[model samples]
Target: MSCVQTFADYGFRALGIGERALPKTDITLCEQVVLIGSGMFWNIYFALLALLLGFVAASLVAFARNSTRAILWRPAAIFIFILRGSPLFLQFFLIYETFVLLPKVGFDLNLGFVDITVETRWLTRAWLGALIVLFLNTTAYTAQIFYGALRSVPKGEIEAALAMGMTPNQINRRIIWPTMLRLAWPSYTNEAIFLFHATALVFFSSFPAWQQKGDALYYASYFADKTFNPFVPYPIIAVFFIAFTLLIILIFGFFQRRLNRHL
Candidate 1:
C-alpha cells in the first residue's frame, strides 16, 4: 500500500475506527505512525489523570507521615514502604487479583441520607483498574519525595509561628505546606516523568487490553511483533515518549521556577 493508503486504513485504528485488526506483514510507515499515535491517547490519559490524582493523594500522605502522632505516621510509612518496596509490576498483579476476588456485584455505599452502589465490575477493565494502580503507585513515590522535602522546611519558621501563638493547623497551612511543596517540586517533577514512562506497562501487566485498545508501547509492540521489526516501531514509541517527557519537564520546570522565586 502507498503511504496515503496506509494512513487512510490505520489513521482511526487507535480510536477503534477504520481497519480493526491493524496491519500485519509489511506494515507501512504511515500505518505505524497513525496506529501508534492513536495508541498514545491512552498513554496521555493514564499519565494526566494518574499524576493529578496522585499529587493530591501524595500531599495528604506526606502530611500524614510527617504528623507526630503514631496514628498518622505509622500507616503512612507502611503504605509508602509497601508500594515503594514492591515492584510496580508485582503490585499491578497483586491489586488486579485482589480486585478480581471482590464480589462480582457492585459494592454498596451508605451515606446516611442515601444508598449508592459502586460497580466492582468496572475495576476489571484496564482503563480504570490500571489507572488506580498508577495513581497509588505515583502517590507513594511522590509522598516520599515530599516527606524528604518537608525536612528541609525551616524549623524556625514553625517555631516562629508557634511563638506568635499560631495553632499547628494554621502553621501547617500558612507555613509548612507551601515550603514543603516548593522544596519538593524538583523531585516531584522527576516522579511525574517516571510515572508517565510507567504508563506503558499498564497493559503489559495483569490488566488485559480490552479490545486491543492499549497504550503507545502496546500498539508499537504489536506492530513489531507482526513485522518482526523492533527497530522502527520501538523507536517511534521512544520518540513519542521523549516528546511528552520534555513537555512535562517544561511544565513542571515552570512551576519549579515560580516556587523557587522567593529563594
Candidate 2:
C-alpha cells in the first residue's frame, strides 16, 4: 500500500482509530514513514504553541531585566540565569515529579463569595507537563536574546524620539522593539529550530506517554526495538525532522524579511 493509505489505516491508530494493533512481523519502510510522519503532527503542535505564547512573555521579561529598579531587574536576571544555566533535561524531570505530588482532587480557592477548584492532576501527564516545561524553557532562552538586543538599541534613536516629544512607551513601541527584533532575528531563528528538536526529549524524561501514543522519536524508538534495525526507521525519522526544520526556517525567513524591510 502507498504511504497515504497506510496512514489512512493507522494514522490515528496511535489514538485507537483505524487499527487496534500496530504492525507486528511485517513492518515495512512505507509503514515507518507514514506513522512517523503522523507523529510529527503532535511535535509541530507543541512547538508552535509554545513558541508563539513564549515570545510575548520573553519580551516582557527582557524589558523587566533592563528596568532601572533593582527589584524588577534582580528577579528577572536570576530567573534567566537559573533557567539557562541548568540542563533542560533535569528541569523536565524535576517539574514532572513536583506536579505528581500535588493533590489529585486539586486545590480549592475561596473568593469572598465563591469557591473554585482548580484541577492539577493533568499536569502529571506528558502532554500538559511537557508543554509547560518547554514553554518556560524557551521563554527564558528567548528573553536573553531580547535582552541583548535591547542593550544594542542605538542610543541616538532613543534621543531622537525623545527630542520629538515621544513618550517613553511610544518610543519603545514605535522605535526600540522593532529594531531589537530585527537585530535578534538570526539568533532567534536558531533558538526556535533547536527548541523544536528538543521536543524529542519529552518521552525520555519523567513524563509518561499515556496509551502508547507519543512523538516521532518515541515511535522511531519502538520500531528500532521491534526490528532490531536502527538503520531504517531512525534514518527515516531524521529525514522527517530535517524537512520539518527546513519548513520552520522558511516561515521565519519570511518574518525576517518583514523585520528588515526598511533596511
Candidate 3:
C-alpha cells in the first residue's frame, strides 16, 4: 500500500479507531512509523495527566514536609523516602497486584449522608492503575525537589515579607510559593522528561493494555518481533520520542524564561 494509505490504515490503530489487525507480513517503514506514532498518543496521555496531577500533590507534600510540625512532616518524609527509594518498575508491579487483589465486585463507602459504590476493577487497568503509580511516583520525586527548593528559599526574603506587614498566608502565596517554583522548575523539567519516557513501562508492567491499545514501545516491540529486526521499529520510536522531548523542552523553556524574566 502507498504511504498515505498506510497512514490512513494505522494512524489511529493504537486507539482501536482504525484498522484492527496489525500488519503481519511485509510491514513497511510507513506502517512502522504511522502505527508507532499512533501508539505515542497513549504515552502523551499518561505523561500529561500524571505530571499535571502530580505537580499539585507534590507542592502540598513539599509544604507538609517543610513544616516544623512533626505531626505533619513525619508522614510526608516517610512517603517521599518510600517512593523515591523503591524502583518504579517494582512499584508498578506491586500496585497492579494490590489493585487486582481488591474485591472485583466493588465496595460501598458509607458517607454520613449516603452510600457510594466504589468500583475496584477499573484500578487494574493500565489507564487508571498505571496512572496512579506514575502519579504517586512523580509526586514523591517532585515533592523532594520542591522541598529542597523550599529550604533554599532565602530567609532574608521571608524576613523582608514579614517587614512588609504581610500575613503568613500572604507571605506564602506571594513570596514563598513563586520563589519555590522558580527554583524548582529546572529540575522539574528534567523530571517531566523522565516521566514521559517512563510511560513506556506501562504495558511492560503488570498492567495489561486492554485490547492492543498500547503505547509506542508496545507497537515498536510488535514490529521488531515480527520482522526479527530490532533496528527499524526501535529507531522510529526513538525519533518520535526525541521530537516530542524537544517540544517539551521548548514549552517548558518558555515558562522558565517567564519565571526568570524578573532577573
RMSD of each: 2.8, 2.9, 2.7
Q: Of the pair 1 and 2, which is ahead by lDDT?
A: 1
Please give me the total number of clashing residue pairs in predicted model 1: 0
- Listed in order, each prediction's TM-score against the native is 0.91, 0.93, 0.95
Q: Model 1, stretches more than 4 Å misplaced? A: 1-9, 107-117
| Candidate 2 RMSD to the real structure | 2.9
What TM-score would you give candidate 1 relative to the actual structure?
A: 0.91
- Tens digits of per-residue lDDT, candidate 1, 136-254, equal 99999999999998988999999999999999889988899899998888888899999999999998888988777777888998988898879999999889999999999999989
**Which is superior by TM-score, 1 or 2?**
2
- Computed on alpha carbons, the lDDT of every model, listed in order, comes to 0.89, 0.88, 0.94
Residue-by-residue lDDT tens digits, candidate 3, 103-219? 888688999899998788989988899999999999999999999999999999999999999999999999999999999999999999999999999998788878889999999
Tens digit of per-residue lDDT, candidate 2, span 54-153: 8999999999998999998999999999999999999999999899887788678899799987679879877788999999999999999999999999
Q: Candidate 2 local accuracy as lDDT? A: 0.88
> Cα lDDT for residue 88, model 1?
96
lDDT of 1 at 162: 98
Error of 1 at 37 (Å): 1.2
Worst 10 residues of 3 by lDDT: 204-213
